[model samples]
Target: MELRQLQYFVKVAKKQHMTQAAEELRVAQSAVSRQIRHLEEELGVRLFVQKGRNLQLTPAGSLFLSRAEHILTDLERAVGEVREFLDPEAGEIRVGFPHSVSVSILPAFISCFKKEHPNVKFRLKQGTYTSLIRDVTEGEIDLAIISPCPETHELVKGEVMLTEELLAVLPPNHALAGCKSIRLEQLKEEPFVMFGEQYSLRPIVMNACLKAGFVPKIEFEGDETDTIRGLVAAGMGVSLLPELALRYSTHIEPCVVKVDPKVTRTVGIIRRRDEKLPPVTELFGRFLMEFQPSADPGRPMDRLDGA
Candidate 1:
């Protein structure tokens, strides 16, 4: 089928109305209808059926839509790669990151990279740890900045940048809040606020508590680090968060104490091992490997300070 036919088919599938699809594509309604009919004929399957005023895809149609969309995305990326090769400084990079680093680490790297390559554009996606890794493996994102970076994955490769400490965060009025360092077992009786199961940090916190000899009693679960911190500050419960996540906490400051055992997570960049990155993505990946934050938040004396 022609490229235009695929384009028209996708547009029609999305709009589900021949007239609206035509309007968006800036083409005659008859032209859109003709193309859809031709596409269906060529594929030897009925793609759409009328549901009152709107059209809906049949099972075959739904399957074809997914493949068609993938083809279109691949074509777009292929074209972008050609243009990027010609002018590496003026291309787009799609990067994924987890919520734990959204406030500090991701911004720091992006700001530093942009200072030298101001014209390079970035599309950043913040997701759960599992989703970020899956996105990289599936080619949804060119790179991902992940914590507790995996050592062995069949589909992706990781480059560990640095290991950062995970500290105990408590409500300011808690008795242990004033201590420099406390054993994990010391807070065993305290109710815990934790990240959801999807986050990589949750298991780390769970395992640390398990190692400390008790299963934590989770009182509240949050998806965002800020939300968990807020819950802790509001006296909801105590939590364990990465040092980077607490670096810029401004509102309702939670007391950040060092865990005596000193739990840490490795921060790293991950990309698909099989795919060759575009010029701009390659450059950014190289920069990340060489870049270091001005101060290591994981240091023992680094207190949680609001920005």
Candidate 2:
């Protein structure tokens, strides 16, 4: 019921011995025992059982233990949230990003942001686009680097960080690889490698194919860009991947071609509107919006990477 009671219960559940729990809590053993008794009495169930000095939890205690731990964790998070609002520069921000972004340009951006705002702390979470959108919409994360925006009900502020055309990856000896220019339709009959369903790229690739006048028959699927590139190198299937994805491919080769140029995705920062973003997040958000992929980062990338 009370927070102290929940904390006491958690410690007791872990230590299992009243004397040890009390010592760890820096309280008298009687106090520890009394608190547990009071909690059990209030809940109308026994929380712990004793037969000699060793302590054990009852069935009821075990169930309560799980719920109690969750409650305490949530309570602590709630406290941190308030602190973040009151003093953002000295508080923490929850940031979510796809693993690819985390590897390519995000880590350096985080390092730069941290150098500028050392007191600001980060709690980084990684997931597919669907999961990242859900976290941002549900208020679990303070900010996120999301791409090819997902369907959402939460209010968001987004800005395009950079835009790069989707390019085709092929084996070194593929016929199309020799062409100075290739159309999406040229590779229509070729087997296509794709990102898994959970990724933001899957829909983008499919829709691009649809617009280009054919539905691709997928040959291989994976979440990793490197793996996708590897598959393309092995002649499994060619893939329509963002320029950033190709940044990881050492074995895989990209054919420089001209296309419609309209097919692209913007990777940017997002936050829920109902909650205020901490100062740390705002600073990071600014940095992300200004960041551009190193190859041709039209804006932020140009500024930061000196391209």
Candidate maximizing TM-score: 1
Expressed as tens digits, the lDDT of each residue in 1-307 for candidate 1 is 9999999999999999999999999999999999999999999999999999999999999999999998998998899999999999999999999887787777777876898899999999888778898998777899999988989999999999778889999999999999999999998999999998888999999999999999999999998988999999999999999887787847689999999898988999999987889999999998877755547553312212312
User: Which lDDT values do the candidates have, in the order given?
Assistant: 0.89, 0.75
Q: Each model's TM-score, in the order given? A: 0.90, 0.74
For model 1, how many clashes? 0
* lDDT value, candidate 2, whole model: 0.75
Show model 2 residue runs off by greater than 4 Å.
Answer: 8-37, 43-78, 81-90, 137-140, 155-160, 248-258, 294-300, 304-307
Off by over 4 Å in 1: 296-307
Can you write out model 2's per-residue Cα lDDT over 139-197, one digit (the tens) per residue?
67878887864334447655566666777777777897887667888878999889888
Tell me how candidate 1 scores on lDDT: 0.89
Identify the leading candidate in terms of lDDT.
Answer: 1
